[model samples]
Target chain A: METYFSAELTDFKTLYNVLKAITFKEYATLRPMEEGLKVTIEEMKCVETSAYIPVQMFESYYVRPQEDVKFKLSLKILTETLFIYGDDGNLSLKMTYKGPGFPLCLIIKHNDENITVDCQIYTMDVDESTDFLCLADECTLNKVVVNANQFLDILTDLDNTSDDLDLFLSPNPPYFRISTTSTMGESQTDISKNSEMVLLFQCENEFQAKYSFNYIKQILKVMNFANKVSISTGETGLLGLQLLINEDAKQMYVEYYITSMFEDDR
Target chain B: MRFRALLVDNAAMKDLLSTVNSLSKLSKDCVMRIVSRKVYFIIPDEDTGPRKPLAWCELPVNFYFKEFNLDGVSQEYNEIYLCFATAMLAKSLSTVKQNAKSLKIKLTNKQTPCLTLEIELASNEGLQNRQLVHDIPVEIIARKNWNDFAEPQFNDFHVSIEMPHLKPIKNIVERMKNMSHSLIVSANNFGRLSLQIKTNMVNLSAHFTNLGIQSFAVGQDNESTVGDGSANESIVTATIDIKKFLMFLTGMQLNHCRTTCSIVHGKMVKLASEQVGALSLQCFFTELSN
Candidate 1:
């Protein structure tokens, strides 16, 4: 069979670290395009996360002309393979995939120690049932961009037992207010638009929604590595999070979208 | 039958203590088969499943002890086999190994069959020396089951090579363990070693080249097995339990010029060191069911 995709790259630990953030799920979808590669993992169809790796990340990349290649694989197994050599050494990676029914082949080289690894991970046909989430046309929108660490700090302070979290966003005194109730009591945290941590604020309309705190907390690992976070809410209450990660001045992006939990409306 | 020994040399005590420590990591129950020449530590088959011996180690009696004495059952049968808990022996040895002027071991009948360990600790200051005694119960094995504890014999190997640094191999095996239960260990005459793990989802392997082939020292009926060029080029593979292999790598720490691994095709593997300082060390791992 002809090779559909092949790429040679060094510094694979960056990609490994990025995939680890979304490993709460076992299988993930990998799509190789001319622009770059995209990894998508979702939790119970309620939350969705995707990571994009650009073509520049590889030293050399090739794809059979006009071939749309996508496959499903175990994310945990792939990450463990990438990290098989360990973290201390500088490992160069060569990845390849043929057409359908072929395993993803990875050749890892540790030149400093004169050791090499060959990994072949069988790929499965992608399940097309996943519905890509986006902001609907008729929904009201409230977008807030803030320092990732500061937003994460506020999230960490919230009560872990609270299942439902109320998010209120507007152009009011408290631009963003997060409140939740538990057996202990009710807790509320407010972040104003005037705060120095707020990098960008845009309000198309007022948006209020209740989200499952567990889904929001699951992707905190991605946020911890982000320099800035873009949070937007839709009228029907779809929470969208975009993380901007800057390492050694190279920018990377991680995106998440979670549907709000409305008891009576659902 | 009577068996007793005394160890006073600090270096010999340390060697015996180190070997006991390794044995403790191996198994709980141990059989001390004493003859006039040497002592053997035999690890019997765990359950009633099969009769394959788990491990067998030899310790020369006169080399490790200052005073060695043994009285066998009869003139024809000149060996005594006694079973004891290995952890208890290692515990006693480690406690008295340091600062003890002399350590004595003797078989005594204290209520049950007990092996008494008397330690004479040398005092550093002007104070008088202290003595500590520990009675470890043992089971005297009858001659009927003597065939079960036979020594493992060396045989022809398809591939024999010096093992690489174990630290890296251990690290990689640990990672692979999370992915699969068993792994494939293969080596070629081209001086290459590879470990592989295969699952329904993935097949991952690590390869190391430029290793030196090991030949056993002469005088043990160990003749060269490599016949032709084609025979030398072929690869020998073994599918073994990753847990047992990892246990061997971590626990078997013998000081030698190099650790040699000899594989008998898909049957078994033998890891041995010609000289562990003054002691000889060897062990075997049987193949796992596919």
Candidate 2:
């Protein structure tokens, strides 16, 4: 299922950054999808949502045969600003969210382009929507879900606590472990004795989907509302995001339960 | 017995002295050492027993305040309301994974055996600490919105009666109704009383067993000298205690009546023999008529 939404490009950049860091491999087809440098997207933060694509993105730059068409929405990102080229070159779209505890829209530079745009943005509450899409242009390689404490160990190894770190992290740990190993042969001439590689998993699934801690953490770095973020993988091999809504309300603060579904590909 | 008689004059002071003597001599008794204490007669009246004829003299009083601080902030005051410097030691120790601090509450008047009014004050950046937290009755009353709140209406019946054979029927119906808003049946010498109270309503009745109480001839049998001193009166004419009337009529134990009265006649008299009994009966009918 898919949904579509219209949101400024800037708001989606950080979200795009987060989504990109978790994807192992992805291919974008210009024929199936429109080729556009600048597009607006709205994503679902919750289960219930209304989705639409921004007219400014789909109408001009993206060469598509269809008009007034909508698609399934995936996620919504709230960022400060996004810039793209119009017929006039160098156009900017601003993103903003309105809430009591939400962060204000921030202006970020795409590149060294001395271009800025002024625009108003209104962030909708996260709800399920069928007509929206949240995508990252880049892709990810290896993803391993580890306990927050264990992940802390991993981050300590990286020691890359730079301001420009594009990593995301969540407190969720995977329930299973998967590893691939290959056996070496003693004699090359023995054709009958063939060597094989085996992959063992703590939990088996028909689809294979994993997430990097850095990616999840970055998307929720400033989120004080939810406690856990759920990670799910789809058949397309893309990581699906679902935030666990906490039911235990006795707590003074809000918390989210995040679960990531390992793909079953058996 | 002699001490009991002395206690009749100064019970609280006697209790204080007994406590001081019970403690070890080595331990300093701060209460006993307090050279000054102040006593105030907020209201002076001769009816309370004896007349002072003058104001109470101010005496020297000494007290001490102890503070327990964890961070030099959130200071807790202990034994501040005491009129003596109590010699009690309170110690607390804890081990934390990381260095942390917390305040502990301890009472210092272990030997004084006095109840203290404790107050906690804090600066408020939020609503919780906005108001001062104190155990003082006046402070507590100040915190409540008694002015805007409505007081619950009470259903009451006042009764009075003067009969020799029947026991005094206090407005027990009204008292019982006040205690529990419901109908009740009571039996005694003069008559049987039925009381029913519903929310803001009340119903009461008295049915005499023999030709009713008013028809029964009541006359002085030249009983005794302790009568009301009226020659023509039969039943002793003693003032009825309205409070006691409610007590007895409500089926509350007769011994529980706080008010006292002189016995001029027989204990066989019904509750209707008292002034409050008659008055409460009148009130019951008046209320029913209204």
Candidate 3:
């Protein structure tokens, strides 16, 4: 028999810290390809989040190029198993999978002791992932990059009772504005082009769309772990958010796709 | 049935209140027994339905109080046992924890027998002295019910070891609690401890070595009988409910004190801690049969 796959990492927590941000779903599908491993989670067909950790991010990476390895496992068990190392900076990890019927094995070594974990997760047949069309010619509306910390602060100040979040983008002054209305009052936050937090802004035309605040709040889960975030809206009311994990050469990305709630639906 | 105590040290009183508050996290009602110079808090586990764990805590009366006097029911029965609501006492103590100058505890005979905490607050500018009194009702237990709250003694322990820093162990236990309902804790005589949890999805274990082994005088007599056998290398393991074990670790308030753990193979586990002022806390966990 051939060796299925095996990979090693020097700083095991880097992968753990990113996967923890998307644990709102119990089961996540893991797809190992030539480029990297994509961990995907979908909720109620309305929102989908994925964290991509490239092969270069691992110290030692190996995989059978011809074979396709895709499996679904419990995210809670995976996260808890990785956290057993207890935030030690000098730990090493080795993960392996044998074949279709074998279990996923993780070996963590710290100091002189080693912990071996065997997870017998039942794998289900892979399902086609929902495709959120991002064609440049058909659906590009607005794109902006903002500091993750500043964006989190603005979202925290918004009234939580409000159900809808209105995003206004224009080429004129006050390039970006986020407003919400509830029975209590209406709160609006305006960000000009000159603000230090707004690193890049591009808009083809004036656009306004209302999205469910509950769906947008999912982005806040990863705000503390990310340094910068890019937000974009398309003509079909599809929202895209990309979070940059670290600024160094070995960076990872966590992306979210959210479907907006239109005015006529209310 | 007369008792009164005066606590003059603000820091020590705060520590006492905090320890009581932590104990309240485990159970809502407990029996507090006071003799001439010592006090003990005991909770007996119930045998039916869900497992109600037991706890025993002891502290020297002079450790936190400046002046203390007590007269029990009689000479033979020198101890007084009172059943009180731990939550009510914790709530009352928390209100005066920050700025109280002195605290006086007295047994009062109101409409109901009550333990009254009279707190004297510090005087502020252009304001007079402030005083706050909170009465917590209690029922004095008769001497017949005192046998249910006796000190626990463990005679047949396979291994007695001083645990490593509790912060790391606590972290591991907290994570294991999320995966399974019970946890398996095993330790050997060679200063190694391991925690394991097994479920259908995963089997996880963490090992800590190079720990300090506490040599107790009781274990010395059994040392020669097992001469060169596997008793020296065998591992003593106990499986316990994760939530109950977690509560015991967090409620002891042993952040700065030394903790020693003893395991009775397939039977029970006992943990003890002693501070500088003759204050000691002990917790026991019974094994759950597989």
Q: Which candidate is the best by lDDT?
A: 1
- Note the Cα lDDT for every prediction shown: 0.80, 0.25, 0.77
lDDT of 3 by residue, A82-114 (tens): 886467556777778676666667777664333
> lDDT by residue for model 2 over B1-290, one digit each (tens)?
00000111122222222222222121221221111132111111122234211111111221111232212111331112222222221001111111212212232233433323222223345534222111211111121232221111222211122222222223222333332323322222233222222222112222223213232224435332334454432223222223323433332222212221122232211232111211111101001111
TM-score of each: 0.85, 0.17, 0.76
Ten consecutive residues with minimal summed lDDT in candidate 1 chain A? Answer: A131-140
Ranking by DockQ: 1, 3, 2
After TM-score superposition, the amount by which residue A26's alpha carbon in candidate 1 deviates from its true location, in angstroms, is: 1.8
Please tell me which model should have the higher TM-score, number 1 or number 2: 1
Tens digit of per-residue lDDT, candidate 1, span B1-290? 88899989877777778777877787898898889888888776574365656667778777888898888888798899999999999898886655888889898898998989998888877868989899999999899888778787756776788888766777788789999988788887678888999988899999988899764233223233455755534567778778767766666665553677788767778776555436665667777776
**Between prediction 2 and prediction 3, which has the larger lDDT?**
3
Give lDDT tens digits, candidate 3, residues B197-285.
88887777777777777643334433434357554455677887788888877676645678888887677888777676856777788
Interface RMSD of 1: 0.8
What's model 3's lDDT at B76? 78
TM-score of predicted structure 3: 0.76
Which ranges in model 1 have alpha carbons more than 4 Å from their true place?
A131-140, B8-18, B45-48, B61-63, B72-78, B90-102, B115-135, B215-232, B254-257
Candidate 2 stretches greater than 4 Å from native: A1-130, A133-175, A178-203, A206-217, A220-226, A245-266, B1-290
Looking at candidate 3 chain A, the ten consecutive residues that score lowest on lDDT are A112-121
Rank the models by TM-score, top first: 1, 3, 2
Candidate 3 docks with a DockQ of 0.31
